[model samples]
Target: MALLVDELMTKQPRPLGRSLILCASALSVALVTGCTSDSGGPSASASSPGQQQKSPSNGSDLTDEKLGKQVEKTLDTAEVSDSDPLFVEAGLERVGDGFHSVPDLTRGHSYKLSVVCVGKGKISLSIAVKNPVRQTLDCDGVTFRQHLTSSAAAIKIDGDGMPGATGMVGWRLDKADK
Candidate 1:
């Protein structure tokens, strides 16, 4: 039977100073050893910090003119009507050879893309678009949400993850009839 630490420590007949020291030493060891390693599965992405830090690019670094043309194409393909404007920063951004580029708007603006009233105000804009990536919380739980932009009663959603899940969502105002 090894010495029962608790019994020995508490059954002290020593001076006040030594008893206090022994108690503190025990507590410190317990606290330090409390942390345990996790056995969860692997992480989502294994890309190193270097790759992650690399600025998002559209592949080919387009020149000013090429960038303009690419951005113009997005609006042309998108539901940007006369009533709504895709206000360009630096007039517009360039598209990468790869079909992607850094996001333009910083969120918090009134500008919109009409998708209902075609020709200039279409209601079939970007509602219900999926999110680019799914959002996740540290197990506490997170509400799924999609990116949304509104024009009048219409809304344009863009991105690419599942809707109504524990991730990002996407949806439009739904005014194709109007």
Candidate 2:
């Protein structure tokens, strides 16, 4: 049994510490945001590190300019500089299960995916590049931000497969400053 365990450990691709660190970081972020509940509503603490407190929008139309303003406010509150060029800034509206695919993304560049729900509904968001899954987030108040490292030609934003899921999901994709 010992030999078998050692062989299995040797066959692993990534160092175990990397996975542990990732899990720890995710847990810390979750704790900081106070999003430990599964109920669909506003989070107890919506402000992330360096983020300002803002009232949750109540089913308002999320136009391009409005979404841009929200993204800018988030960036400003998070202390993220606006010197970096935006790769994609678009709004997505869907009534059922669907995905938005973004193609021709620059390799080795970091990207931020910000999602905001425009109406009253529950949403679960995920990201994928070809076959590999990258990140998944489900939060209340229908807002969350995820940082991703791009390595593929395209990426897909999935907002589906959740039971009774329906809403207008607004998204903003920005490239991080190198």
TM-score top scorer: 2
Q: TM-score, each model?
A: 0.21, 0.44
Model 2, poorest ten-residue lDDT window?
133-142
What lDDT is reached at residue 29 by model 1?
Answer: 87
Report the C-alpha lDDT of model 2 over 3-105, residue by residue, as the tens digit.
9999998885577878898999999998966655433356545545655555445544344336445434543423444454565555555535345656457
User: Total backbone clashes of model 2?
Assistant: 0
TM-score of 2: 0.44
lDDT of 1 by residue, 1-178 (tens): 3578767777946688898998999998877655331222233233544334333243333333343343344334334443533432112211111111233343433333311111111111123223323322221112122334332332223322222212111112211221
Alpha-carbon deviation at 120 in model 2, angstroms = 4.1
- Which ten contiguous residues of candidate 1 have the minimum total lDDT? 116-125
User: Tell me, what's the RMSD of every candidate?
Assistant: 16.5, 23.9
